[model samples]
Target: MSKHLLREISENIVKGDSIRTKQLVEQALEEFTPEVVIKEGLIPGMETVSARFQSCEFCLVDVVVAADAMQKGVQILKEKCRKEKAFAPKGRVVIGTVEGDIHDLGKNIVAVTLEGAGYEVVDLGVDVSPTQFVKAIAKFQPDLVCISALLTVTMLRMEDVIEAIKEAGLREQVKIIVGGAPVTQSFADKIGADAYVEYGTNVVYKADELLKKKGRRVALIQLPSILKEKHQEIFRKLFDFTPTFLDQNNRVILQGEELPECCRECREWNYEHNAEKTVVYSCPGGLSIIEARIEGDSIKLGKIICGPFLVETPGKVCVCAPGAKKVSSLELEKIAIFTQMIAEQIQIESREKLLQVQLEDQREILIRALKFQEELKNALNEARYRSLQSQVNPHFLFNSLNSLARLAMLEEAEKTEKFAYALSRILRYILRNIKSTVRIAEEIEIIRDYLFIQQVRFTDRLSVHLRIDEHIYDGLMPCMVLQPLVENAVVHGLEPLEREGMLEVSGERKGELVFFEIKDNGVGMSSDKLREISQLKISRSGRGHTTGLGLFNVHQRLQHYFGSNSGLEIQSQQNKGTSVKVFFPYIPQ
Candidate 1:
């Protein structure tokens, strides 16, 4: 449970869930020491956010929010850090953004990353002048001085700050490292700074070098082995949301949802620098979505995208609103971090699965599977044998009927021959489809044989209609489903009626499902009787039956295979009519 909490803490931090981070840090504190929480959760998450920023997979906004979440968590663990000595403060460092450049996102990230690494970070806010740098040095006598700048013009201030520390005679007391978007290694050398750093996490190694310190101050975070493919499915399970995508060509990659994604051409937006853009697309349904693109260095390397979220909820919800979820702006920032992490994790896992397997393990797994092959085959055969034993024999009845049909045809009794042929066809259909699924078209043929036999028997009193749509003819359903209801309509409903009996079997394809109805006009059942049939407490025939498959048996099978959305529904009025409507998933083979 502690390990799970640690994972959640790391995830929440990556998600920029700051309010929840503070709570998680406190809960984790009860199970783990402050150092353990920071190392296992806070530092790893912040490092991931920073790396994404450097890779251009995350914009400044994502890093800033993730850093803010880390800061909130660190604030909770501050006092405890003063008590524990495992990850005691390594050194005191004064860090801030340079003068005339108001960007402190870089500085805050550096401070938080360093602090999470067990350094005592004295963040002197943003826009610190050269005098402030020297003043901070005089007061703290820090081991290192880190200055940041985000613009070309303000980066020169780093040199001025270094010069002031020299003039104040504090140069020998501390090492100065220069870093920012505009600061380069050559620029750092020209400015006489001790070291130039690019990534915030890399700064820890550089700081250790500048101070001649040793012994692994920071731990690198690696995704676990369980991380695998199904990147889209994993994200949906984790966040209760579906994510959309864009291909390498920068075109919207679609998955055929009811809601359409933006289908702009590749040339419309440049993919070269898309890694830096915060994409929030407005869908055709007027719902806003957040997206992050993680592309490989080569064209063959694919991208993991995160979107399918609304910026804000709609006043009048979209007809396709279920496809896109709503999230806060801060939660959206965390997605950029998470999208890149999972994308890289899956790619890494895919490569590692092949490389890390041993010959002995592979051979053992193959040998074990082969050893069980015969047992598996025997078990399947035994199960099928048991299933066959539970059902009544239909072959003997079919053979005897076939002989009677031949004799009737020889005697020139046309009605007798046709009735026996229809009965034989129904029995053959039952035998063939008993254990397998059947298309509507195939199932309808058996129903036709059943109605034919009944029509011949009742002649003037019976009337039947089949208004089936050809569109649903190819849709699949459980075998022996429609015929049972047709048998019930003919045997129980029509046979008991004094007036002309009427029956209808109609089915049609509606969207992803097919709707089927077996309605009858006869001596209709009462409301209480309808309830009893629906509740599975009574059989429609009470004892004598056509096929052994009852209404309840068909109902149970429908629910078992297709879920609760399917199964039997009985509606009737005393002496009026009864209708059994059924609906289930429709998949055409």
Candidate 2:
């Protein structure tokens, strides 16, 4: 009879019949335990919804409605579970969209999916700044943090959040997961996120994996044999320092070396204070180590050295290279990840021995670990890519310097000095405002400088005119915004022409929007070329030199910073002229 009721409950949930689901929950509670009803009915129903959603049998709206039905049923079951003392959450998660972005559709779906997976979720909603995430971490003390950003502009804030977590000394305590349309696994790795979920439903599995890795432990007696030959290699190559294990009495079990003086002091303090939670400390030699208490045992995990520099308290794991003067937070995070993997292997061995699991299951575990290792390798490669992107492009700098030298050699003292000043201003602005916005007026000034340099190079063959409203000068926009458009206009539209070329730069305010137009009378593109550029089908080399790259980057930045409606509109005709108009919501300082 209860099985029949459970089946009915699952059907109602799939159908998104909230009223019927609630009614069925109440009826089931009268006959069966809340644990049974939740385990057999609500969980299965949500799983079916997730499966259908993944399979494309159910749309986003359908899944959302189904989730609502499931939530209602869970709410009713919660009371019964509490009364019966059978309530248990799968995990705890704190989630939010990054600052400067208000899109919540993707975030909502992830939150609901996590909740359906039996996680106690703390939803921070949208436009969540780095400080807010830090505060939430301190308060909620969640096992995981999921950050969402739909726009590329806002996606950059994820790095800021990770930095804030490190500053607050809580980076090691929780796992971070990032997702959204613009977010990629590479970006996640670059931002030092623990995991990246390509699909919303995958969040559940990733979260589970992270939690398992965190709670994983290995007894000292079982460590060496469990890891076999890979054990020594991991400690020496990854951790730098030897691995040490301690028993309840503070006696060394797997002897490696005496604890560093600072680590010894921390251990003494922990013993004196009866510290139960994990503690992280840095030694006088500038090595970072973490000490965590093993659950249900007197044995404690000793301070595992991460790298040469000390990370602040509360970060879960630290990864860094040995003999380095300074270690980046991201590098430390990688060390922490590898440490968890090692610990996971230890835990797996323990499980195999205790549960006597099949040989196939052991092989499966090994395969999963290998897959994780591949992910780590990819993340490291992406980290290197991010490092490259952070530096100024040498080619551009070299070209600008050459142009300035040419002007100096021509005895054009005024032009040389002006070009040097403009180049300095541009580089200085980029360096100072890598993660910030600037006023439109400030951007316009940079654009004027940039155009001046181009005008001098082209001499009488090039001319530019600027007409901007003073009233809208204080409107805020991303840094280096206008300069790219101006550069694209001159390089792609004006420089190719042999005859006189005219460029017009203008701005105005209309209602709630601010518009800027860059018009050039040079070599206008044909209709087919325009269409190809619009569709982003033309490669960088195919679209003439810097034109395609600069234009595409600027268009993407505009749309990311403002909205989809706020981007470049290209109007051109072959051999006539090209006009690129950009607009965004008027946001006053």
Candidate 3:
């Protein structure tokens, strides 16, 4: 049993079978410790996959599938492992996509990489504002801050991020790194970022490096390599010393005192180049080294101490003023290559995840569809069975009232009384079973009586025309169709128009087909908006939420009774008129 269980775990991992991985993990629960499975089997497997991923021997898809396989087992093991093992958080990092950009792929990739590298990563998601980042920083006090963006428009958000950090008074303590398609070293430097990484993998590396380099004063290296001989002499004359000094790492460090005046032009240029750029000191409360690129030149000046005059801060620092050179095509190409590689790896990882998600979703949909079909079949069978067993559903009662009205009218006991009695009964029935289907003839009579009542309600402000064919008298239709259609034309359509409008209702039967048409010459819908009406699925309710379900409900009921091919057809032209035609196959007794 032990050997078989071990083989099961190994086989699932070697095959990169996520489903099997889940099965193995479940089976292992009876005997093996969750910690043993996680630490010995899953974690080691993931480590190998990550290595294969880095070596390019295994594409990101393979690695991700392997990761998912591991995650499946790890998830089951995690809760148990928490109880069984002492787990320590490997430093926290807060990450977000900057404001105005909604892209999350880059940020998600970085987060996954950071977690894989054993750091606890808190993802703040996308479109995060400066204040939000600052608040997060203050709350988390993370070892590092990571910001990402994809669009050029939102790239300016990095400056906002910098300002937010400064405002929180934790700017010095937190090391900041920026990356994305549009982010560059110049942008990072301008925004006062501690570092800028080109890719997600590099993000992990940068975070680690920044953590190691924390508390150590980094020398600002000047670009002494690009200064022309003549410019170097002029610089020497102005400063009475060499403008470049190589600190420990060949980074140019400049004298803190000599840099203030020379840096004024570049500060103005910073403002000129970037709207968000301001001449903020290198450090908020302490003198610190800075590298400033001379504007519109191919020279970069190395490090200089920037602070209050005569505040002597002792430190081994080098200032080298490099030539102010436009970033060459070669350098831009390198950055692009690295970003694209990272994006590709991320894309592969995302695809694997998407595929798994799609498979799961498809399984759920299939199950749901099968269940719905069964319910629909049972509903249809029940409906037919009920139809056979039932006698008359108030429709017969309505006709009996009409007959009673005729008899009363013959006796001459005031015609209005008989009409009112019939009206009250019809209204009561319609209110009772708003969802039930009635015979076509009965529905037509209801419409006729409704129109008669509305003529009295609106008092000559409205008019109605109704016609019916004898052949459809026995066909089934939902109650309240004609009344609501007419009501719609009057209340929403014709009432809004000042002109006297014509409302027409006609019905006919051609062979086995029953057709009902309602036309109104009032305010009509435009082509664009009218097209949207068909797609609208509204709920039928008397008062709650304005269900907008009147005509739509009638249409759905028609289709429900007479198959999908037979339903409502509506047409309208703006400010002219609207027409609705209902077609259904008449099934005779």
Candidate 4:
């Protein structure tokens, strides 16, 4: 009976009824501890809210209402606990966005997630100064201090906060974590932070890892197949809305309508560029379409297409076709939730083999792609192309994508620019020289670029440290040599492992030789596997392997360029980590 009542309390919170929620909490307290009431009742509702928020079901207004209801229940619990003197929070946290940055959306999410996770959170609102942080650490005596900044320029305030804490002699009392739109693990390490996470959901798990020895796994997901009718059924049950699925080319494969002629004005709007959706976006036609892009690894596969539905019944808000479905604004909120779920499901299904095959195919193509450029261009124009080809208006897409990019730039231009340039530099370097020798500095610089990209992708999961002597920067090595080994360390070594990843790249010169190493604390290879790798050979190397460039290709090229002694020496033990050593004669460029 108490369990039944507790479930009702959760439901009421979801409905955002603070009055009824408080009354239910009063009833619940008679039969339950405040902790039980919080964990089993309030947290579940807020967790649902969080899930819905992630999916787009709940907007900021919805979240505020639900949070208010939750806080009402929490207040009642706090009073009860005070009377009993028996409430214990998991830990205390001090959270804020750093000074000079006012963004707090993510910070708000983190605070809420931590509270639900049983941490007592003290929120220091946006544009928080370093001295303010230092004071809070001293006053709250928190177990963790979380600093967030949405802009690259303001994120520097995190380092200042850390310095202030150190100056206050409060550094030893709390672990510090930094997060934001543009913050990276390299930046975190550079700023003397304890951890860096891409999303707020990771805070509790990450905090637990820092405070305790416990660990959590963060995995990547991709859609393996097209959406089916069954998935549409889910939307129907939840929102009285079924969806259409379209391929990348906007070719409708399932239940979908042709985009309204008015939507042509939005032709330059690219849905595939970002992980966000439009809710009840009205086209030039009186009818409206609700839509969300289906993306994998930042590529748009298709859209979970819905609508041409009415925002209001015909002849009310506006006239609609007699057969068109009418949807309420509240339902649009629900659609956000539905869209997020389908998109995540698409992403979470493991498509490792498919992606690997695609990677190999692209590598094989690119090495020879330049030679067949004209033919390929002709083929692309005449043959029709793309993973899921459907026609789209380039202008609408460019404008939409360009606008989104501008918004992101407005928030964090420095980091965005850095990533774009880094990728450009790496791609340009890869294409220019496949069969040529290059300076060690060139290899190291590209590796840094590669790692920077990985750091952004993996966030808290990957941390790197590089130590190189100036002596080897100008030394010669085959082009694209070291990057593959480093890539191997990341993909084969660190990525598959369950724990946090640690990567180390070091190079130094000794006498007549230059020694370079790529090491990872990941799920290492077995002795037999190591021996097999040792014996592996490249049939013919033009550019690179299973990934982009194979380890054997690098080894074979190094030996060919220098001597037998100048190749790779790998040592590994399963569940431990792997280290690959590269040594060659000190040949200057």
Candidate 5:
């Protein structure tokens, strides 16, 4: 029983049960040296469990439970190992479920197996967002970025995270391994992911392959075998570096280190002095080189050699030097294609970043619009606020005018018929303009009738004039926009003062927006009043006869038609006249 318990404790440590592992290790230590227990019982037990798990002899839970037991046993020996700290991690890896995915069983299993293999595993929990993955990459700067996604929908999001890395130009820095139920080797290829493993157990081999390639590439580049231990400044510069090459007859003849003859030819006419080895390389197009060689080690081609040559046949390697190792031209082409793929990946990542920013901006704008809309809805719900059409008190205007006409008839007033004619025209425009939208000309005509009626009512006290630019009458506007402003002008500007007042109405098209202005030289509003009225959320308050709904309601209607920027602007003082300028986006017919 004790031997079995000790064996179980060792398995748990290998499986990453840091919690239960210590307990079992301590229990095992009561009977043996912490070191002896770890060697004879713990290590061997974990090896057995790992084989069983990998070979399908043990199920996932079986492995996990055994790992938990093993962790407890390792803890008992940890104090002794600390004094003598001898074991080295097999490898280190950082793993996570990709952005927008929550499934993690596969990832967890892989983490366990990697731990069992003596690797230090950083298992980031599920549903990791792209930003989180990027931050983790930046933080740990791990040997690999292992991403898992269960759903096809979520798997695609991993492409975005990869793009983020590419944009930062970190694609070549860390290897990327992807896996999930929906993921395939093709998907991995399509996204430029380094490797794709289908099963958790398979990840062990995949990691080994990836790490080996990484090491070989580093060795080929003649850099440090352990890339992770390089100086931070070197890594920073390395990440930013890109390599370009020259090819001969569809063969990669020269890596970036050597200058191609084509480049020297282009520079032959120029006046730059330099002494360096010359070689051949492909430029932007088929083959023409520009620019002097930059100072640095050409990562692939060891030393700087300069010259140009052509390949005799396909699949032939361009010999930079007779004895140097030759690289397959096809392989070089794949590398070049990979560079372009990296650039495109970067562009995609930038777009996603921009999209995220736009969404945030739109959300803020929508929130403000909703607040303004709520305020307008509340103002429109008032009991006394009548529709603009009904607010003019048409019955009162007609009855008063009729009584005056009867008296004028008895007295034979000179313009009695003309006065009645103007009133009829005004009422016709008001009753007929029902559609929410109408041509600018139709709206202006409505204003014309309203002004004519105002002139008749206060012929001597009010002087109304309209001067609309011909270009302004070609667009469309909300129906009745002009009439209400005219009403407000006559009622508030002219009626409030005994002196004669002048009201001018005009409009013009400015780019994609239509601008309307109503100028009144009547008792202008106080600064406080103007400020309150200019605010979109202020309630409309005035006497029953002077219900403050006219200007307020017009403001709301303009906003409803064209958005918040469509509201009125009052330029006024207590005595000076007020000028209300309204702007609406012109929807061209």
Candidate 6:
């Protein structure tokens, strides 16, 4: 009848029916204890919901609704227990997401699961910095602290939290657990966490296991010679009897041959080789006494035979023999329990060592991967920069050849020779500097050569002005940054105007940055064209008819070298003028 009521309560919680769950808890209180209701009813229901959520049978909204029901049910039980003075928390847990991470769904779920397991949980919510976690540790004094992060960027803060706790001298007081989407077991180990759980439901069991195994008391005994002088004190504390060893043939090796009459008789019987063929045996008074106990005698014997048990460290086999005093059943039970705890502790230590080795192997692999990724990124950037440089060089050469051909056709030999000389200088500059950056003075010399060629082509229709700050002559910039913008102004802005067009190039140093401006009083762009160019969506009507490719190429290279802050800014008014400003970091030569 009690089982049926508990099942109904569990089903209601799963259904997220809060009213029904509260009523069931109140009703169950009359029959079952609060501990029984929590363990059997609420916890089991939550476990089922968590399993469903992990399997994708339930979504976040469904889990939230179910958690609401669970919370309501727990609150009613807490109130009831408080009035009756029966509330006893299983353990205390502190949980939060690390600094810079605002994602908290996973952290919240784990916190609720710990609460459902009867732990007193203190939830420090999302974006909890390292200092906050250390402060909470001092205030809460929890058995476990859980750190969570969903992003790779924020996941590193878990290590900071751990180091803070260590610095605060609170590391030993609590066990730390870390988890999130980007978190792995190897990462947790690297950060010195106590345990890492991939799933929320597993947090409950792992927390319980860690708390139980940590700081446990066990009796340790040295081996090989069980009668060693150092072990004498431990033996005396655990047993009244002086222990003895037996070989595989069941021959008794007494502590000393100080013979009691019973031990002499027992050794004689064993010398006749009449002991039963078994792993362990209990000795009685002679062969007759052993047979009597096997036949259901309740007599207390003077000494009992125990063992064929194994001990770690230096391995050996040994049997135990009680002292001259009579052995009781309770004393035998104590001996059994003590040995068992030692065996369990050894197994736990062995598993931890194996896991540490695996974590180290994983850490090595991650380090190699990160190094390879950095190399690959550099290679891709170089390939992209070279590709952009290739496009600009060919386009400039074709236009210069066209200007030279027009002068040749007009039969002007002296002007043709001058144009050819300037073209040669520009070509020589581009060929020599295909790498990333060059001095501002060298770049300005190349720009002057380029503008001279354009001015010779346009003749009276083009006019030029230069305003350069002498202090900024040593600053560095990309190789061909100025040539493309100047070419655009001469070809699109000045060439289209019938009257004389003016082009101005200016440079100045502003704090850490060097600013260059190219202003032209000619045909400027419309709002649509300006917007299109700013977005790198230039139409065929723009300068060079290359669809903004040259501007885009220059912009990309600027950003690549000096980050996004150092790039082009363009302002233009149709039929009035256009001004293009370029920014570069002032790296002194």
Whole-model lDDT values for every prediction: 0.70, 0.69, 0.60, 0.71, 0.59, 0.66
Per-residue error for 361 in candidate 6, Å, reads 24
lDDT of 5 by residue, 480-580 (tens): 66676667777876788878899988888766667889999988888787756644224433222232336555654565566423546668878778788
lDDT of 4 at 84: 53
lDDT of 1 by residue, 1-589 (tens): 9888988888887889999999998999898866577668877787787788889998555665787788788777765554553665778899988865566655765666666567887888777888788767766758899999865645767888888766655675678888987688999999998889886657778876766531111101112232333656767677766565444444444341234333332122222222353455554444544455443322222344555456554554445455566776567657656766665665565445434443443454345444444555788899899777745567878888899999999999988998898898888887777778888898998899899988988988999999999988888888988898888888888899999999999998776667889999978798787756644357433332766788656754675566434545678877788898888778887
Pick out the ten consecutive residues of candidate 3 with the lowest summed lDDT.
Answer: 270-279
Q: What's model 6's lDDT at 582?
A: 92
Better of 1 and 5 by TM-score: 1
Candidate 1 achieves a global lDDT of 0.70
Q: What tens digits encode model 6's per-residue C-alpha lDDT throughout 1-589?
A: 8888889889988899989999998899899866667668876787789899999998545666677787677777656644554357777889998865666656766775676567887889887988788768766778899999865645777998999777666676689999987789999999999999887657888898887655231111111222233333344556543344332233443352233454444542332112331122334331211110010011111122333122221332123323333444455445544433432333344345435644664454345434544655798899899888886966687577767756775786876766676676666667677566889998888778788877887877788998999899988787888888988887788788888999999999987778999999989999998877754465322344332337766765675577524767789998888899998679998
Candidate 5: Cα lDDT at 404 = 74
Q: Candidate 2 residues 321-374, lDDT tens each? A: 233334554665565555555555555565565345335434544454456456
After superposition, candidate 3 runs with Cα above 4 Å error: 1-419, 537-549
Model 3 vs. true fold: TM? 0.31
Displacement of residue 326 (Cα, Å) in model 4 is 99
TM of each candidate vs. truth: 0.36, 0.39, 0.31, 0.31, 0.31, 0.34
Q: Of 2 and 3, which scores higher on TM-score? A: 2
TM-score of 6: 0.34
How far is each candidate from the true structure, as Cα RMSD in Å? 35.9, 21.9, 23.0, 30.7, 28.2, 20.2
Please give the TM-score that candidate 5 achieves against the real structure: 0.31
Which stretches of candidate 4 lie above 4 Å from their native place?
1-412, 537-547
